[model samples]
Target: MPYDGFKDVKQIVKGDLEQYIIYQNEEVELKKFDNFVNLNDVLNEMEIHLKAYNRVASIQFYGITQDPETHSYMMVLEYEQMRIFEKI
Candidate 1:
């Protein structure tokens, strides 16, 4: 992901994502993703990509507050975007 020209880029923040489990009989797969942007536009763009690619299995966002009590702009976004490769 690119964050060039993102003026409000203050302190660096990290993101965390939950696990995604996919199972079929005796087959299973897991996927995870994290969002590392503080801007709303970037995050929205990601949502668009997820929908377009059909990779949006599940999503979650944490730690978004504008109160002065918080010390950091930390947040965590979790998503499941899976890709499959098979022979036609």
Candidate 2:
């Protein structure tokens, strides 16, 4: 299910390899790593967080895109079966 107070754009933090976006949620803070993060690492990280919420079934990576105006990058995440959050 979609988060109740979801926002399209959240806080952005720039790093050498990735831009991190911390998606605000009532239940937990969801992070989107917009770079070449290792898939296994991402899965492992998500698994730890997802366990805190009983509603979350799985986490899926929806790939990445670059903003035309800012040239910034974003990675998308889907929680459970709902496309609730994206980062850029």
Instruction: Quote each prediction's TM-score.
Output: 0.23, 0.29
TM-score of model 2 vs. true structure: 0.29
Which segments of model 1 are wrong by more than 4 Å?
1-38, 55-81, 85-88
Computed on alpha carbons, the lDDT of every model, listed in order, comes to 0.30, 0.41
Candidate 1: residue 29 lDDT (0-100): 21
Backbone clash pairs for candidate 2 read none
Candidate 2, residue 75: CA error in Å?
8.2
lDDT of each residue in 1-88, candidate 2, tens digit only: 2332344554433342223333354222234434424656655655554464325445465444444444433444443333332221
